[model samples]
Target: MSVQALVRWVAAGLAALVVSAMPMAASAQQPSKSSMALANEILDIKGSLQIFETVIPGVVEKSKATLLQMNPNLFKDVDAIGNDLRKEFAPRLAVLREEIAKIYATRFTEQEMKDTIAFYKSPLGKKILTEEPNFVDRSMAAAQDWAVKLNDEVLQRFRAELRKRGHPF
Candidate 1:
């Protein structure tokens, strides 16, 4: 390549790098503590988890029940379902925990998450977390019922469409 062409390419590369660095420089400015707290306030981990628990309930609890029925070695007290064996079942829950924590973490800064956790530590936050599981349990059960009906309707529509089009499977 000619020297002029090489110099132009280098300048273009330098421009791109400088543009990429702008976001990092702006983010490093560090939000104020009150801003962090506000972020914490707006970002609702408990509300999100309640949504989750409603969606999944305690897979561990259900699994332990199945385990006890199958083996009886686990779920000896029914409370052991929440015990160290959670690590044994960690693989199943790891992705869920990571994904959920990520939604909470990435939405806020470090100090913001800390402040959020601190709020959840108090009476109101603690209460929300405590009650959310049951509420979601009911909500998810209804959601499941709705999903079944939706699936049947979609299936019927697909079959009718295929028949009308005279498409052979």
Candidate 2:
């Protein structure tokens, strides 16, 4: 490349880097479309809900398996049992769905939803909304881990005290 073109290209690259690195507000930030924000929020919430949804099926399947395992003749056909359960409980799940929808509607205000949508439209906000579920889940898992440990410690202490008193361990 010619020296002038090389210098111009270098200058353009540096300018792009500096511009990208600057605060978004310093750059001419366009306002987000509320509909797009709402869509993304819905998607994010649905995605987060799906993340922890395995337990529902897992619990059901495990229960079914345990019932059959404990009593080999309890179910003539396990598949039939499962199908019957699905058919029976499917309607009830609508109740759960309504309950969950009501909870979300109550927990988040309409204005809060608008604000969240607006925030998620921003690059930083998008990053945060994307990362926050994982962050929250991990933090919660950490807290739960500690809580379990604390419960165990307390139970062990009580057990030891009982043993000291010549009660059953």
Identify the candidate with maximal lDDT.
2
* Tens digit per residue, CA lDDT, model 2, 1-169: 3434333433443464345444443444333445334534554644433432333454567778998888878677775777677666656644544333333344455577776667767888878867765565566567768999999999999999999999999
Error of 1 at 123 (Å): 3.0
lDDT values of the candidates?
0.55, 0.57
What is the alpha-carbon lDDT of model 1 when measured against the actual structure? 0.55
Clashing pairs in 2: none
If scored against the real structure, what TM-score would every candidate get?
A: 0.35, 0.48
Top model number, TM-score: 2
In angstroms, how far off is 151's CA in candidate 2?
6.1
Candidate 2, position 20, lDDT? 42
